[model samples]
Target: MTIMVLGIFIAVLTFCLELYFKEFVIQHFHSIADQMVDKNGVEPGNIEKFYSIGYHNSLIGLIIILVGFIPIYGFPVIYGLISFTAVGVVAGYGYIMDYDVIKTMMIAFVPHAIIEIIPILYSMAVGMYINKNIIKRLYLKKNNTSKLGTMCKKGMKSYLLIVVPLFLLAALVESFITTFLIDRYL
Candidate 1:
């Protein structure tokens, strides 16, 4: 129930942000894409191109979720591996930067991060489903004019519904939890 509420809140927040600050968000995404392209060799292009790449990349999270759901080797094992790896990377980066702030930020982030990250993972899973079918129709079979457009439109609607509110809820959690924890514990 909490998860559902959080997801809805994030989705709504994302929608409102997009509506009021579309250019800002787009610019941010463009900057991030540019950085990624420079650092990771992603191609440089317009928003649509970046979105396509993003949609495909989101599949990795979906794959993780799927792997996590396997009966014998499930979410716990997968999560542990990911958590360990993330911690290692963060630690390495912190060491390189000679900054304890990263650790402090991580501690502050973790409480709300779980609530926020799950919806994003779920959204990516949903996006990947749409992307896979589009890829199949457009690339593999060389059938360009299929029902993919319709599917994509529907998928975008669904994504908007899920992602916007989830992000808002995440923002709320981030704002409130950190302050509350600090006031109580510090």
Candidate 2:
């Protein structure tokens, strides 16, 4: 639920960012693609791409789930950064294809965007929730290693149990279905 809400908000925010800083955002993505191209060189097969997506998305999930150790600032900042990158991606795709923002976004988001985005959002939500409780404990001087350990364990359990599978599914959809759809339709 939190993931859905934040994802929607971030989608809208992405549009706004597109309106204001289009060049910068598009350039950023070009640079990232350039770096990836320079590194990968040869195009990966679909299966390799799928596995790569899983690995990268899982890393994002882990960062969101684990950044709770830094309390209020860490998870939220990373979450926002991730969200900003998503926006840039949408905007950048539009620029690269010379498509209008709306058309580009329609193609980008419809296929696998929700599947890929929501899990990380949920992981970030879980991290933020745990961080809140930890902050409360600190404020009350009720904090201890055992309690924090328990919280970390509980948060990680949920993230691993829930987010990991979702990431895998998202990766599969993105590498297979989404790209196929995009190639066929767009």
The candidate maximizing TM-score is 2
Task: Report lDDT per candidate.
Answer: 0.49, 0.71
Write candidate 1's Cα lDDT for 69-180 as tens digits: 2333234233323422333333433334455635544655567567556655565455455555555655577565337566556655655576545655555655566546
**Residue 144 displacement in candidate 1 (angstroms):** 12
Residue 151 of model 2 has an lDDT of: 78
Which parts of model 2 are misplaced by more than 4 Å?
Answer: 1-10, 19-26, 38-41, 77-81, 92-97, 143-146
The lDDT leader among the candidates is 2
Error of 1 at 3 (Å): 19
Q: How many residue pairs clash in each candidate?
A: 15, 0
Candidate 2 per-residue lDDT, tens place, 1-186, comes to 655566567666766666577667667767877765536587676798799889988888877777766656456446735654576557645765577766656674656767766686678777777767766676656655347778778887887788888989988988888778678767
Clashing pairs in 2: none
